[model samples]
Target: MTTEKLFKVNGVELWAETFGDAADPAVLLIHGASASMLWWETAFCAKLAARGRYVIRYDQRDTGRSTTYPVGEPPYAMSDLAADAIGLLDALGVERAHVVAQSMSGGTGLHLGVDHASRVASLTFVSTTTGDDELPPPSDDFPRFSTPDFGDSAAVEEYVVRAIEAESAGVFDEAAARVLVRSDIARATNFEASLTNHYAMKFDGPQGGGFGELTMPVLVVHGSRDPVFPLAHGQALRDAVPGGKLVVIEGAGHGIPEPLWEPFLAALVEQTDAR
Candidate 1:
């Protein structure tokens, strides 16, 4: 069974859901830019839980059911998002956990490993960048997608489906995509806050030498065809963290598709169990 609740951290209420036994080892999953915990997918969480892990997924401050500051730019820095992750762990009474972070949230994971190393058992960065100066930017061949009209539910759903299909072209599931989009629309209280979160990542400058401080095991997963961050991003992340392992999925893209779930779960389980 899964338990869903709101956790207050640093005066912000973050919406979270957990699966499996509380006594089991914990795995905290952090979603990407402008995404909520819904992005983690129910099946994936259940599978991870089945591996005897206490899986936890949560919405960031400006997204989903979490508290939002919609009137202006988010009042917190990227470090604050890192603190929120630790705060959630504290609230759940989990002294340490393996972190599975996606896209921009990888920044948060890096921060956790640096600023709060004692709380993280391991780090898994998925389709994300290290914000290092030496890495190449996104591919020029990558298409620029227009923003969707959030006020129109159909438009939002269609937009989400298109985006997911584009990112996970080989493994897109229409039914699952619809469900995730619907859930996000139903619970989104502040659209502007979500945009602000995107801006925070957009302007956040280079992060130098932080990854070198992580003493725990690190796993970097990226798709071979990912146009956003590209494979080089993952390679740079692995290079930055000492003894980090990289798992590149052939013919895959930015999103974790259905086809890669088994391999991804296996990698995650391995990292979590290693501790």
Candidate 2:
């Protein structure tokens, strides 16, 4: 079964959707910056849920149908986002959950594994870095598209499609991406706000608290060809945490492409199951 609801978390309403049985082990899916729960496509969540896991995906403060902040002004900090995660879990009566975080949310997951270790069963960080200053910068070849006019829906959709194309390795599906882009724009209270506010969001302190602070199982999934954070970042993360594992998606880029779902899902399942 599937369910959707609005949760009052951290004094803000966050929109959440869940798939599979409530009785099953819960796996929380946190998308990257400026993205909504739609990024974790319904089909992907369903497939993960089919593996005897309850999957939960939600929109952060300034994304999707959830609460949005004024353009270029987000009041919350990175730590506040972590608190929001805990509040969401409390509201759901979930004592513990396996967290699958992508890109920006990876730092959030790391914080949870450190400050709120009791609440996180396991952590899976995808396409993210360890925040180690020594790491290499993003790939020079990785393309970036310019933002489109917010008032023009077609322009916005085209921008999203082009961005995804540049981010994917070689298996990008323009049709599927367009569908998601349309939904994202249509449901957002202010799509432009997310784009602007995320950059403005504050950080309570340095992200990725001491690696020694983490005691739970940790998994780092990165594409071999990751444009941002590069494969070295993933390797460093796995090496930092005790018993942390790494899974490299061959020929993949910044995000999880459709073709690499099998290995990605398997690695995720293995990490959670190990716990």
Candidate 3:
């Protein structure tokens, strides 16, 4: 069964969707930056739930069909985003839930693990960066595409074409690339502050309060081909947390839903069982 609901946190009405049985153990999946809960990948989430887990995916304030921050409002930090997780749990009446977060959203799980250990059953960080500082500089190959300097139609069109070609050569899927780039561009245009808020991981703080405090069984999953975040970030997370398991999915890139979906499900299942 599935249901869509709305709940408020910090004056923002967040949208959430729930899947599977309520009687089953709950697994909360948080998507990466600039992405909606759809980033969780429907197939993966559905298959996991079919294995007898209650899964929840939601918009993180400004993404997808969620509430928007008002103009002139102060920026939201990783901690504030963490609070939204807590609010979701409370609204759902889930005392403790396993957390599966990717990219920037990994910090949300970490924050909850640090501040409210009792509320979290386990954590899975995927395509995650350890710290913004330790990250290897952006891949040199992605020069014009990575830059935010695409100032016009011609530059933007060329940038999108290049990105698609890079994603897969010989196919040149301009239609697919246009859809993705357009969605991203629309998000940035509609909610500039929220986009800025999503990128503001600097608030993750020094050492991020240390993973030593997370007593729950933790899983760190990363892909070697992931460009946005370096593999070293996964290693750092594993090193910091006691008994943390790291799963390196081969050939998977920044997006976990595609090439890495199976391993992602397996790692999540193992971590949930351990927790």
Top candidate (TM-score): 2
- Model 2 reaches what TM-score against the true structure? 0.96
Model 1 residue pairs with clashes = none
Ranking by TM-score: 2, 1, 3
Candidate 3 error regions (>4 Å): 70-74, 132-135, 144-194, 200-208
Better TM-score candidate (2, 3): 2
Candidate 2 yields a Cα-based lDDT of 0.87
lDDT by residue (39-104, candidate 3, tens digit) is: 565667788888889999988866766765543353677777888888998999998999888877
Which model, 1 or 2, shows the larger lDDT? Answer: 2
Q: Each prediction's TM-score against the native?
A: 0.92, 0.96, 0.82
Comparing 1 and 3 by TM-score, which wins? Answer: 1
- Considering TM-score, which of the candidate structures 1 and 2 is the better prediction for this target? 2
Q: How does each model score on lDDT?
A: 0.84, 0.87, 0.72
- In the range 1-275, model 1's lDDT, one tens digit per residue, is 79999998999999999999888889999989889888898889999999999999999988988988754567787778888899999999999999988998888888888778888899999999877787787777655677776677688678767777777746667888888787887888876466456565433422434787788999999999887787899999899889999998877889688777888888888889836
User: How far off is model 2, as Cα RMSD?
Assistant: 1.5
lDDT of 1 at 35: 90
Q: Write the per-residue lDDT of candidate 2 for residues 1-275, one digit (tens) a residue.
A: 99999999878999999999878889999999999999998988999999989899999889999899899889888888888888988888899999998998887887788888889999888999878999999888877677789889899899888888878866689999999999999999999997778778985653555776688888889999887788999999889989988899998888888788999888877777725
